[model samples]
Target: MKPPIAPYAFIAPALLLLLAFGVLPVVVALLVSVTDLDLAGLADWANVGFVGLENYRELLADHGFWQALANTGIYAVFGVPAVVVASLAVALLLNRSENRFFRALRAFYFVPAVTAIVAVSLVWGYLYNTRFGLLNHLLSLVGLPPAQWLGDSVLVKFSVALVAVWRGTGLNIIIFLAALKGIPREYLEAAALDGASELRKITSIVLPLLRFAILFVTVTTVIAWLQLFDEPYVLTKGGPLGRSTSISLFLYQEGFAAGRFGYAGAGTLVLFLVIAGATLVQMRARRFDADH
Candidate 1:
């Protein structure tokens, strides 16, 4: 009994830190979401009376918040799946032929993931500049009109999405490559014996086995997209008539920039719930397939 108690005691410190740092902040934020707290009232703890979800009500009525929500949805819907497919294709290519050049190629894909996002955004902004940009220069060579990549309201969101796809596709490729390698060679040989083509074997064997990895990639990518901030914040600044503003950017502006702390908290909470629910649905679908 004493030995068992000692092991439990050893785990207590880390658990306490997790509770303090992770759990407590979430609870406090939930409480803050129900109030009318602003920067001027920050020091007045006693005045922070519960307003019983008026912040949530206000968010529902706010057109700016709704616009942000729509932009975020569009980003997630288009951007995440495009990244997933591109990454999977790259991973499939790299997982084959263990040549030194291919090994180097694997590393090359991940360089963007480890690079500073602000620096990457700055370089991309220059490339997206209407007049002197590399993208426009190439298009000019082909006699196409120089289109405003980041400046036009209609094209800004798609431009931001393209940047996101470039940066995000690498991580998912690495994950899918690892999963592909984990697949046993015996299955490939067996499929070949049955006169199965590469495409048929991949469809029948490889994909079924890689389901979990695919599910994981999809869920995590969706979660990241839901919390999209840095790229849009740095590149577009929610500009071109607020066409590229995501929910997270909107929340940041409301909470910190405008000092509408409670309303921002409410927006944050709504985002949390949306991500949580979406993840749960994906997990449940996976569970159902496993059961079947």
Candidate 2:
């Protein structure tokens, strides 16, 4: 008991930091969400009053908020699967190759993951310009019509999703590669001896064994999709008739741009709850799978 208490003493500092940096801010934000606090309210305390659920009600009714939610959902629907499959495919290919040169390939795939998103977005913005973009120029070489990539409302959301997939796939590739390498060689050998094809082995053995990693990836991708802001902000500015606006972008517009602090806080809280619920569902599914 004394030794256990000594271990807890070492953990105390990290726990304290979490409370100060994480817990305290969340509590303060929750309190702020219930009050009608704006910039004026910050300067003059009497202007702030308890507005209760009004903020939440207005947020739910707001068309911009709903559009943002729909856009985020669209992003997650397409982006997550594309990233997951692309990453898994890259990892599989890397895992099978036996050359030192292939190790360099891993670095190439991971480079975008570590690169600054702002810088990448700016560069990609130029690449997506309607008239003189590298992509459109290349398309012209193939006798294909140039697409108004970032300027068309119909294509903006999908275009943004493509960018998200391009940027996020690298991290997922690394994760899946790690998981693939962790898989026991004995399983592969045994399956081979049983005359199972590579595809069959992957379908029956590899995928099932990699279920936990899949769950983790899914949960993280969903959360990241919901909080999408940076790419759309830098590239599209939620433009092309606001087709690319995400929930986080909407929250930023309300809180910082529009100065509707309390309403933005409420929206943030709602988004928080949505993410929390998604995480909970993932945990429950994982638990159920483990039990089975």
Candidate 3:
């Protein structure tokens, strides 16, 4: 039997886009990573010299790289779970009602995700301002001193991650809501008839059924956090003694700021591997849990 031509025709454009934007960049980065390609190399290909794994070796020893890696890990550790739980909770609440008000509320919640990152960061920047800010004004009402949200090294990680988490949850809430809608109403009715509490129904039935959605959200959330960039870039500028400098930011600094493209490419490849490994581990754990 011949396969339908219509499906392939529909997918052809997307496949071409992925190959050009996604696959091609990775391949070029891989090639660049093996050479000592700097700003000069960009203008003259003859200046490029292959350095083998030297770039990787230097990256491994660089304290800045390690700090950036650690910062990214911290962001993921705090941001991923927060986004998942907050989005799921919001979805569960919103899913309870389908009225006009609730429908409008869903759109309101998703505003952060669609808004420009610069605009969101600017709003948050004011909120995090040390003085003459809404947050500080609120604290002054209680006779408390103003806290340095983005200025303190220790507090900067959470400050930056919080913005990302707030921005990230909007989309995930929609995903969870979609998954929640797919769940059969019969299961809830049966549980209700059996004298199960709302909490009981959710824990034993709703959550169990939402495992696939939960897994999908978790893996993607982890990947997003690992590549943390925009919020930190715009908010703190990876400042306060580089405490908020994520791996992605570090690569940006090296590649463009310092004109060390090859070194940055090596770091890019490492970051890619870390993302791939983390995703695989999550998926395998989910599979294992399902089997058990």
Candidate 4:
């Protein structure tokens, strides 16, 4: 009895912290979403009135809300695959050589993973400048016309996606590098002895073994892209006709910037549901694959 009680006591502090930080905030947000909380409400508690799903309904009808949701989907759909593929490619390239230079190169490649988004945005902001940017200057050197990287509607979407891919792939690349290293030499040697080509071995053996890492990168990249706030906020400010406005940015604009706290909470809940649904679907798919 003493032993069991002591084990529970040891974990109680962690449980209390979780309740205070995680559970409490979410519960409070849920309550706020159903009420007409705003700047006025912040001034006077009596000003806050229960609206009960009215905010949610308003969000469903708002065109800006829908467009932001769609824009977020564009990032998740486009950026996640690009990040996964590029990370895997770079990981595979660097995996071939275990030399000191390549090891240093791998370390360099991971710089963007830990770098602050604010810093990346500042650097890329200059890189995407219309007339004087390095990227456009190089394009002009090749006789191609310089294009607006962040101002044009269509290009801005892909520009931000490219920035996301650039900044987001470093961590996944390391994950894939580790995954590739973990593959047994015996399997590749066995394939070589059987006269299997490099491509065949990769397609048949390497990829199958790296499935978990691929799924992990895919799921997490998608989730991160869905929450794309910092990049667009810093670079485009979700501008050029608001073509690049993301759900998270939209929430920020509504809640903190606009002082529509209830409206913001509703949008927050919507994004939360989207993320939760994606996670559940991925879990189900993974379980199904495992079962099969």
Q: What is the TM-score of each predicted model, taking all chains together?
A: 0.93, 0.93, 0.97, 0.92
Alpha-carbon deviation at 35 in model 1, angstroms: 1.5
TM-score of 4: 0.92
Candidates sorted by lDDT, best first: 3, 1, 4, 2
Clashes of 4: 0
Q: In terms of TM-score, which candidate is strongest? A: 3
lDDT of 2 by residue, 1-292 (tens): 3457878889999999999997886787788899998878878998899999889888888999999988888888888888888988888888888688899998999988888988898788888987899999999999999999988887888888888888888888888888988899999999999999999999999999898788888888888887889888888889877788888988888899888889888988888888889789979988987899
Candidate 3: C-alpha lDDT = 0.95
What would you estimate as the lDDT of candidate 4?
0.91
* Predictions in order: lDDT: 0.91, 0.87, 0.95, 0.91
Collision count of model 1: 0
lDDT of 3 at 49: 98
- After superposing candidate 4 on the true structure, give the runs of residues whose Cα lies further than 4 Å from its correct spot: 1-22
State residue 153's C-alpha deviation in candidate 2, in Å.
1.3
- Writing each residue's lDDT as its tens digit, candidate 3 over 1-292 gives 9989999999999999999998999999999999999999999999999999999999999999999999999999999999999999999999999999999999999999999998998899889888788888999999999999999898999989999999999999999999999999999999999999999999999999999999999999999999989988998878988899999999999999999999999999999999999999998998899899
lDDT of 1 by residue, 1-292 (tens): 3456878889999999999996886787798899989887798877777898799999999999999999999999989899999999899888888999999999999998888998999899889989899999999999999998988887898999988888998889999999999999999999899899989988999899999999999999999999899889999889977889999999999999999888898998899899999999999999999999
